[model samples]
Target: MAEIAVVAISVAKPGHEELLREALEGIVGPTRKEAGVLQYDLHRDVQEPRRFVFVERWESQDALAAHAQSAHIQAYKKAAADWIEHAEIRVVSKIA
Candidate 1:
């Protein structure tokens, strides 16, 4: 089995927590249902309203690459177009 871990940190527009949550729901929901996905989770900081994180595990790099091409992911990008301030995504391999 292949494992892929990712962290996405993003800052959204002020008063956009609800919007961000909706976007995240779209992301997490579909991502979890992805063919190669094993885990997908969302996180938020209690003290930080605009900060969000997503943790995902896929079957392989090819699976992750396929996730990038999904229509829902595209919609997520479009829905978050102007609201997202900055995003940092990382793909990691766990140490055995």
Candidate 2:
């Protein structure tokens, strides 16, 4: 199976940037240690400080599914939900 890549963008509510950032950062360490996690990176938009992005690569669909069900991810969702004004997530395949 080919690898899976995920691009997730989160926009924090006004005055909630730091809180959302902390919640997002908290998942990095554990996610990197998960099985089949080729890459799991978090980025903050330079021009838009309230925007956060996650660039992730997984070994397979199963791996990606596992990641979605991870305890840390669940926690992040709970912690960031209220602070997030909106979110966009895309899963893609590498054609190159």
Candidate 3:
């Protein structure tokens, strides 16, 4: 179980920025309310609007798995599917 996860997502579509933002923004509330999530932050690329990064902390890998199956996350996925160019997700154990 990873205690932390750093997700680097890149959306390739030129016109899908709004969709991506909506999807990312939509999941924030639900993720914050989740029991497993300790912290979550979304970063948008200033130079490249298509690139986005999500830094997330969880109690454990189990918690992360739970987040993956969350309804809000699912809905966001659906909404942003067409706009997603690629998703690069990585889970890492917290050192601290």
The model with the greatest lDDT is 2
From the highest TM-score down, the ranking of the candidates is 2, 1, 3
Which residue pairs in candidate 1 have backbone atoms (N, alpha carbon, C) closer than 3 angstroms, thus clashing? none
Better of 1 and 3 by TM-score: 1
Clashes of each: 0, 0, 0
Task: Please give the lDDT score at residue 15 for candidate 2.
Answer: 100
Per-residue lDDT of model 2, residues 1-96, tens digit only? 889999999999999999999999999999999999999999999999999999999999899998899999998888788999999999999998
Q: How do all models score by TM-score?
A: 0.90, 0.97, 0.88
TM-score of 2: 0.97
Q: CA lDDT, every prediction?
A: 0.85, 0.94, 0.81
- Span of ten consecutive residues with least summed lDDT in model 2: 72-81
Off by over 4 Å in 1: none
lDDT of 3: 0.81
What is the C-alpha lDDT profile of model 1 across 1-96, one tens digit per residue? 468788778888887878987888777877788898888889887898788888888889999999999999998898897888778899999997
Q: Which ten residues in a row have the lowest lDDT in candidate 3?
A: 1-10
- List the candidate numbers ranked by lDDT, top first: 2, 1, 3
